[model samples]
Target: MKLTVVGGGSTYTPELIDGFARLRDTLPIEELVLVDPAAERLELVGGLARRIFARQGHPGRIVTTSDLDAGVEGADAVLLQLRVGGQAARQQDETWPLECGCVGQETTGAGGLAKALRTVPVVLDIAERVRRTNPNAWIIDFTNPVGIVTRALLQAGHKTVGLCNVAIGFQRKFAGLLGVSPADVHLDHVGLNHLTWETGVRLGGPEGENVLPKLLAEHGEAVADDLRLPRTIVDRLGVVPSYYLRYYYAHDEVVRELRTKPSRAAEVAEMERQLLTMYSDPALDEKPELLAQRGGAYYSEAAVDLAASLLGGGGSPYQVVNTYNKGTLPFLPDDAVIEVQAAIGSNGPSPLPVPAVDPLYAGLMANVTAYEDLALEAALRGGRDRVFRALLSHPLVGQYEYADALTDQLIAHNREHLAWA
Candidate 1:
């Protein structure tokens, strides 16, 4: 099968290439295309990709191109991983919102909204081109603010499914703690993309025994430590909130800490510089260990599994993905995109039914869902009022004055990316 990666030049691409090489049997690829606008980075990454494939003895032909249309033409699937404004823009995304005395993150809060506004249009345009080029191809989106991006694609009538490493990351963590294989662990992972929780850690399958309580009882401290949350909070919730929750649960504290430390974007930018230097080495045939610290842990595995199932190859029958709710969480609109476990196949992911959500989590989910709705509206139909309303709706930026100031800051920092501005 022919597969195309839209941002194959990203430093993260080597991690993906390593997975493709190791898991060749799961999803046999005949031709792999790397598409990116930046020719220099693409050439460097593409060379390493070819070297990795050769070192692995994989026979797939690797191609690199700057032409999006030609790169995705007649492909079985196209993976979108582009960062519209690159890390320089991300530095802004992770910086401006903090000035409003709020958490400045690339995927949630005011910064996330800024990213959504910038990303959705570029993704939609690419999706449209992919649609026009090959209607049968599945568009696998791995962009940030996945819920919003996926929702935009769905609304545009594109065949797409969003992918994230959060669920898989949780599964692997729980499995390692439980002394079991990662495949044997299943998570009752629910909520929107980054705004999710592991309510139940089931072993075997969806209907398997829920071992979440046992896990907490035995390894609460370790789990809490990994999430950077207090053990008391984990014990009280009886669930593991995603690390992203810290931005909400400890907003002021996180803001204080963020103000003290260098932005994550700056750190990643430096790492990319180092990684690119590593990638250019002719003798380096594998993904470097430093890539692990670069984040997106297990992303390659998640992508391979999702792609295998979507492409009609035999992969795990069930997995966590971001797709239309379709009433899976009765509280959410059927059109809302949610991250949940689902049965995967060529027909696309049908989100598995989730048990009744706790009002604690459900209320937050509903609130964020509304904010996402408004965020998407702002993304599609640009206006300062829409941006203001969306920020006001967000739990993180509920105060009208804060929302008002944040809107201007978001617009100012992102004027180059926002055509409306």
Candidate 2:
């Protein structure tokens, strides 16, 4: 069996390769293919993969290339981890939405729409390559805004699965806080990526009721610690939330009481200022990197865990990831990407059926749908109308009367970043 990783030249590629390498015992794959646009980046990853194989004394083939069609040929699984347009593009995603009176966070609001518009086309192109080159392969997409990208692929009739570690990572942390092994915790997680809530968490050795409330009451902070969510946000959200809580809590009322609100307009202005100054000031380019160098532990674990689960090495239970819910989720459309529990094997992921979601969850689902639909329309149609509709439908926008002014300013603020002709 062959496994191929697209966008193998990314800053995160080394860790992704390490993820697969760490699972060498369970998945005895014949070859590892790394495909990217830049030969220099591919060479770096190729060298690393070669060294990993040599250290392990494995004779498996490690092929690195720039050709998409050739890279996915005869593949059993293909992992998509590309960052289309990179940091400069992410800046646009972060700043442009705030200019129009919406949250400018990259994974939410107009910011996410901007990201989806830039990402979907490239991801779909690779999906097409996978279709042609590896007809039976299961596309494991780890791309950001995964819900959006996965929907696009499904719409195009491709066999694909979106994978996000958010739910699994958070749940594992919650289990640790309760002094229970992750293998013993069964939780019901629903909603879109980033905007999710756990309805229940069952504890004890496979035959017990939920112990989450007891744990949360006794050791909240310790439980929250493992969640990786900001402490300030968790303090307000009233639950062990995910790191992406910043985006979801940005719309929560209790959170607003806890944190000072920043003017979207001001933030947008500041981002534009910083971006301009950074680009024009040559000194900014010469500044030393501030982050301390460290081993790639977090980055490497995700893909390795996933690959292990896929190969059914008795790794942790398959955390059902990006899949639609027909009857599985009452709050969302059956087709919406809802991360639930599932079983993973060499054949791929199989989602578990879930009970109906709570009524409150329906509202959250509706609010997210507004943004998701707007994003899809803007990406496929490329116009101000869809973007405008998105802002109007936003849950927070309805609470404020400045929708028109916000929309106009955002359209103009994001004009350059937007691809509309």
Candidate 3:
């Protein structure tokens, strides 16, 4: 069995590839291919993969190429992890929203809309290749604006699944805070990417049940300290809403008071600089083994657990993943791709239905749907008016009429990136 990593030159390339290579024993993978136009970085990661293989004395063959045609020729699975416009364009995607007096976030609002416009075309082309070169292969898309991109791929007709590190990561965080077993924590999450909410969290085996009200009693505290939500929303909703609360709460009064405002754009830039430094510095590279233990103990364990579930032997229950909504939430349209409980397997992903959602959650669903639909239009329709409507419907953007003016500015400013209306 062969697995290919498209855009394998990305920074996250080492983590995913090294993780996959570690799975060869269980999944029985035989070949690993790295595909990217950035030859220098591709060779860097390709060499690292080879070193890891030698250390383990693994039999897997490593292949590298700048040619997409040659790289994807034969593979059982392909991982899509590319940044469409690179870091510079991604900066634009993050900053444009702040310029509009809206929350500047990467995976939602006008930023997400802009990102989708640049990303969909590339993914569609990749999907076409999967159809021609590896018809039965599954494309695991890790691109930003995942919900919007996943929808566009499905609309263009392809087999794919969008992956997010939020749900499981958040769940583990909450478990540590609540002092409970991670496996005992079961939650029902609904809404689009980066805007989801946990309707109910309970503990007990299949036929039993236990709901802990005290867990959320300090909703404000949960937002402020427990879940790290912004003070603005914790002051209002009295609870933290998972999925990018930092960006949404950046301007919140309570968040400002708590002094937990979103990290400044410059701070983000610094973080990126540090990441590059660590990658290039020989002193850091000399300690390659440390990368396996890079994150905190909790996250490192969680990553291992997830990798085991996805590729390890002995079929585990299908964990919910990012896929077309179809009917995950009763309130949203069937076409929306939402992150929910799903069963994943060698075949592909199967999303689960929520059956029902709370009223507040229904409202959240509406907000997320509006944002996702408009992003789809921006990619598929490219109309300024549609983008205007999308921004108008966003909870953060709909707060004032000024948001419309901002939307117009954003649409006109980025018109070149938009698909032909």
lDDT by residue for model 2 over 144-178, one digit each (tens)? 78888888887788777787767666656667777
Ranking by lDDT: 1, 2, 3
How do the residues 229-330 of candidate 3 rate in per-residue lDDT, one tens digit apiece? 545555555334664655554545423432344434445555545554555653332224444333222322323333334543443354436787776676
Checking candidate 3 for backbone clashes, the offending pairs are 231-254, 231-255, 232-255, 318-343, 319-342, 320-341, 320-342
On a 0 to 100 scale, what is the lDDT of residue 77 in model 1?
96
Mind giving the per-residue lDDT tens digits that candidate 1 earns over 81-190? 98989999889888888888988999999999999999999999999999899999999999999999999999999989999999999999999999999989989999
Worst 10 residues of 2 by lDDT: 286-295
Among residues 3 or more apart in sequence or in different chains, the pairs in candidate 2 whose N, CA or C atoms overlap within 3 Å are 100-410, 325-334
Pairwise lDDT winner, candidates 1 and 2:
1
TM-score of each: 0.99, 0.79, 0.82
Highest-lDDT candidate:
1
RMSD to the true structure for each prediction, in A, is 0.7, 6.6, 4.3
